[model samples]
Target: MKNLIVASALSLALMGGPVHAQTSAPAPAAAGAKASSDPIVVMRNEQRAARNAFNEAARPIRAERAATVQAAVDKAVAEAKASGKDPVVAGRVARRQATEATKPDFDAKMKPIIEARNEAMAAAKARRDAAMAQR
Candidate 1:
């Protein structure tokens, strides 16, 4: 679950071509980093970067969802108290409504990122498999 969230951003990040097109002069390795010429490792780094971007993009959507849920809960709780109904049940219903309301926006916003992430992951897997077969 955690990994899915981490490795889930796509498109421009992966399309930067560092994974597929290795430069002649590699950049200096960062502190404590082990730089390599390995294609699989390069691809893995690209995937990680894409996922990071995805997570960053998701932060706003998640924030909006939280706000929406809070608003819904507040309204429902008030209504429940006025009608002498169970606040607990009303809260649950409000949460579900909030999720449903935000779901479409989430899906629309995330579809491209998700597709890109999947493509990059698949390409990496294929490259790794081919390398293993050669070995």
Candidate 2:
């Protein structure tokens, strides 16, 4: 799901072109510079590759943490329902409690990965914007 979101955002970014891109197709580069050799483009590709690797490494940890939190919520909801309380309210309470209870452990496991991904993406965006502005 995180992969899907990252892919979606990049696809949208590429398909939409730069925010200030002209409607008319751009002319060939006057400097004979290939996009493959463009530093900004290369950096973007490298950042994306790093993000993919981070996602791969973090996937199992995320899945395990999710399963643990979900199990807690399920048990709480089941117990509440068995006692005849409203499942909706019970689920809401259970979700909050379970998430809070599990947050510290989850953060310990995933926070750095999340922050690094965000930071890398943000730096890439800044680089891309600066490159576009230089156009």
Candidate 3:
């Protein structure tokens, strides 16, 4: 299911690209300067690669944590239903409680990865913007 969702998302992203991008190779940079050699381009690519690596590393941890939280939510909802409370309100309360219960653990696991990714993205964005401004 995760694989299907990820594949669908990737395919949708690809489909959203410029329509003419499929027609031919992109034009080379001027003066024979390779586009890939540009520092800003390199930084952008590195940022994406780092983000992907973080996502890959975080996936299993996230899945396990989500399942644990979901179990708590299910248990809460079941208990509430057994007491004759409104299921919708019960679900909302369960969700909030589950989220709060799981948040500290989730944040502990994800904080470093999130911080590194954010730094990489910020650096890449700054470099890319500077490069664009020179054009």
Candidate 4:
């Protein structure tokens, strides 16, 4: 009976050996990598990458929006003068008209950009959350 009990215990220990071994051993470090094993550092890196991508995506949209608004303002001023208005008054009117004309279009164009930025921010937050959960 003792022999049988010892054998059963040995078998159980052997069956659980891999599990214990896995938990006991530290994961091998990567070659030449100095990244802190901290979850926060990993999360920050991910967020930084997302921010970089968002900035890259936003740059062209910003440039185009600026050019379009400028062109619209210029057109408004030219049109005002062509109508025989005083240049100062025309310019004021043009500025208002240009602003009004561009407002909706600008909002429309910016909606997607804003949404994209929000998505990036959300993704960054999600990554951070996940990383925090790891701790």
* Best candidate according to TM-score: 1
Of candidates 2 and 1, the better by TM-score: 1
Give Cα distance to truth, residue 91, candidate 4, Å: 3.6
TM-scores for the candidates = 0.62, 0.57, 0.60, 0.50
**What is each predicted model's overall lDDT from 0 to 1?**
0.78, 0.79, 0.80, 0.72
Candidate 4 local Cα displacement, residue 135, angstroms = 2.2
Q: Among all windows of ten consecutive residues in candidate 1, which has the lowest summed lDDT? A: 25-34
lDDT of 3 by residue, 3-88 (tens): 99999999888886755475565556533443476767677677877799889879988898879877877887898889988877
**TM-score winner, 1 or 3:** 1
Per-residue lDDT of candidate 1, residues 3-120 (tens digit): 6665654555676667656665555665224365466776677677778877887788778778988999999999999999999999999999888988998788878878887787
Every model: Cα RMSD to truth: 17.5, 14.5, 12.6, 21.0
- In candidate 1, how many Å is residue 99 off? 1.3
Query: If the candidates were sorted by their lDDT against the true structure, best first, what order would they fall in?
Result: 3, 2, 1, 4
Q: Tell me how many clashing residue pairs each candidate has.
A: 0, 0, 0, 0
The candidates, ranked best first by TM-score, are 1, 3, 2, 4
Alpha carbon deviation, residue 104, candidate 3 (Å): 1.2
- Pairs that collide in candidate 2 are none
Model 4 regions lying over 4 Å from their true place: 1-37, 76-89
